[model samples]
Target chain A: MVKPMTKTKFLERLGAELGIPPATLREEAPLNSFKAWDSMGHMSVLAMIDAELGCEVPPGALQKCKTVGDLVALVGSKLES
Target chain B: MITQIASHLPRTVLANEGLAQLYPDWTAEKIFEKTGIRERHVVDEGECASDLAFAAAERLFAGRAREADYLLFCTQTPDYLLPTTACVLQHRLGLPTTCAALDFNLGCSGYIYGLSLANSLLQSGAANRVVLLTADTYSRLIHPQDKSTRTIFGDAGTATLLSKESGSRLHSFVLGSDGSGAEQLMVKTNGARFPRADGLPTTTDESGNVHDPACLYMNGPEIFNFTLKAVPKLVREVLEKAKLSLDQIDLVVFHQANAFMLEHLRRKLGIAPEKFVLHLEHCGNTVSSTIPLALEGVITTGRLKPGMKVLLAGFGVGYSWGGCILEW
Candidate 1:
């Protein structure tokens, strides 16, 4: 059985994918604020989530995520199911 | 055997700085860093695909113009809907009237498809000499304010000569399509389904890029995901068909979609940087012309040599994808 991903782990993974510092990835951090959060970054995040969580994050759903917490919650919900 | 390839780009150049003025949020450097494209050649007003195609074919001829047995012109943007562009080209290029010529509609995957058709024609003994031409003026089909499509597309034409040989260097091909993803990258209007008379209103997407219903619209993320899922499988299939491993191939030439997507696919496939052709910095995605343009670049630069095996892959715009191997 796979372990449930924690918020901290999710942030770390996303940070690595986006080339952002983990310390800067607070739950309230605005995703668009990061220079790396462009179209390519969005695709990389989706790939990272798929690789790390084994869940395919739809591009539409990924686009709906505005804050770091939203992304974590999106992945966490998918993980629960 | 594949004899020679020649490509022609429009004289007008659109640099990143010119695009930066349209999208103030992104600087020229940022655009270059993101797309790996510094500039693209765009056709001037009144120039069409056939003009570019004619120029490329003329260059390929260069006093060696001969009567081709068949002419294959591949493009989504034809000079006219009626009377195939190839027929016009045959007349314009001074090919014999006895030659068979036709137009096939495809986008980025066109070059590979053209090769497959040429190879088949040669194998079947239907044609001794095949002139495969790929050209597009996608710039005319894009909305001026749509930066997503505007920044990435360039106008170009390419002509490749194929002749029958007992030991033909052109080998296996793997082609695929997903029509369901057609809407993801398409011009919703000006087609049989949605006539221009319908007058669909121009709208803007979340990215601030405006789209006229007749203009080209690309869902970048969806296309990226589709490529990620399709290309590796396509590569593997071609390799399997050729009974060769990836390492055995001398070089991989893919459609010049953009720098970011190409880099991502390259890393995913574990292809060595030097073994991969990256020539699109000077001419953004030229739709059907990209692969042949890259092939010409590699040959001119001496990166590709005679007897070397090359893997060619092209994907986009039809959600069409194809891969093939050729011995240079």
Candidate 2:
């Protein structure tokens, strides 16, 4: 079974992917608030979630994901189940 | 066996800085950082994919077009719907009357599809020599204000020459398509099913990408999801059929969809970075030509040497996927 991922670790990894430090990544911050979170960044995050986490982020979640916490929850739940 | 590979990129370039200037929201460096593309070559207003393909073939031929016995052209952007572009190329390239030519429709998975077609003809002795050309101008199909596709695709053409020695260096191939994902990445209008409507409505999604029936539309996330599932399976099956292992591959060249996607896929597959080739930094995603372009890029640097075992995987557009092991 895949180990359950925590919100802290998710933030760290996502921060690294976007080249930002984990400490600065506010969980409730809007993804659009960051300059790095553009279309290309969006795809990179999806790729990272799959390649690293071994979890397929549902494509439709791209529309629903507005905050960093939402993405963390979506991916975290995928790994737990 | 495969003998020669050559490519042509148009003179006009759509650099990232120019695109950022047009969009205003995206900066040049941000565009380059994530996509790993600084610029992409685009065709002139009147130029076409066939022209690019012809130029590539001429580079390969060097006035020796008469040596070809078979021609295969792959494209979604054909020069015309009536006369096959391959027929036009056969004539323009001065191939002999005995040469047989035809066109096949595919996008990202095109080069190896052409390779498979060429392999059969060479193995069957139907032709002693073959000219495989892949060309596409996705720039022609993009709506002016569409930022997503505008930043990603470029126009290009590639020519790969293969001879009767296909039994040796050219190894096993695995090709598959799932039409269920067909609408995910396609051009819907101007075909018999959806004829072009003069006043057809165009819509824009949350991404600020405009959608018009006459233009090319790509659901990027869905395509990526499909690729993640299909490509690894393709690699497994191809290696199994070829009776080889991942460690045995000397080089790996996949379709250069983008730097970010390719890099992640390479890491996921555990292929070393140096072994996996990326050539789209200068050309962007040239659809069908991405494979051959990567191959050609390595050939120039002498990184792709003779007698090396190379793995090629192409997945996208038609939800079509293909993989093969070549003993170079």
DockQ of candidate 1 relative to the true structure: 0.36
Over the stretch B1-328, how does candidate 2's per-residue lDDT look in tens digits? 7888999999999999999998887899977876789999999989999999999999999855458789999999999987989999999998887899999999999998999989888889899999999999999999988888999999999999999754347777999999888988888899888888467788986556798878988887778877788888999999999999999999999999988788878877889987888889889999999999999888888998878899998889988989888777
lDDT of 1: 0.87
Give the Å error, residue B297, model 1: 0.7
Per-residue error for B188 in candidate 2, Å, reads 1.8
Instruction: Report the Cα lDDT for residue B17, model 1.
Output: 99
* Cα displacement (Å) at residue B31, model 1: 0.6
Clashing pairs in 2: B1-B165, B1-B166, B307-B328
lDDT of each: 0.87, 0.86
Q: Give the DockQ (2 decimals) of all models.
A: 0.36, 0.43
Q: Candidate 1 chain A vs. true chain A: TM-score? A: 0.83
